[model samples]
Target: MKDFSTEITYKTSRSSGAGGQNVNKVETAVTAIWNVMESAMFTFDEKLRISEKLKNRINSEGLLQMTSSESRTQLANKKIVTEKMLELVEQALFIPKKRFKTKPSRGQVQKRLDNKKKLSDKKENRKFKF
Candidate 1:
């Protein structure tokens, strides 16, 4: 995961869900915003890749915004925001190692040839004389 020691800025807003009267009273939900261009944690190349991969999550100003209201506490929501940010960074940084092309081994080639010869012999024996 990318080492992001930067503190993400968040604004609290009430969520519209089945939370009863307490939902309307308390603004425990957290909405965090991190501008990809302004982030000091990621390099230019890393930011570009992350922005492209997470384009759907970013807003018009190229800010990666996320909201978490799963819990009733602001601290819990803040933790969720951090988790989400780390998750996105980890996903964007993942690069599959390239595989080297390889030919069939001699044992495998011989096995295939033997199977073909066995099938040919079996077919030859199945023929009926006039």
Candidate 2:
């Protein structure tokens, strides 16, 4: 992904899931925050793209935040959060190819009409005689 490592900041907190006694003792969960508005690594257009694409994840302060709690160690959780943030940014920056509109082929249209006619004939044959 685009190098935005300098723009990221990490915070650790106690993981909330299953870990028994370790959950209370260790701060394993990591939150990665990226300040999109203050990022020097992104251009105005790039920042706009990210902000628009990831609006749900961004807070009022323009910080994009992600969390990881799968790992037992803070360092592992930090790595996972950072990777996830990068993946999210890369996905936001991607522009999908435009769809080219096209009409159905003559053969396809004719096939559909034929099937409709067959169904109509079958239904008519099944009608009760007067």
lDDT of each: 0.85, 0.92
How high a TM-score does candidate 1 get? 0.78
Model 1 segments more than 4 A misplaced: 5-7, 116-130
Query: Which residue pairs does candidate 2 place in steric collision?
Result: none
* Per-residue accuracy of model 2 over 12-120 as CA lDDT, tens digit each: 8999987899999989999999999898888999999999999999999999999999988889899888988999999999999999999999999999999999999
Q: Which ten residues in a row have the lowest lDDT in candidate 1?
A: 1-10
**Top lDDT: which candidate number?**
2
Number of backbone collisions per candidate: 0, 0
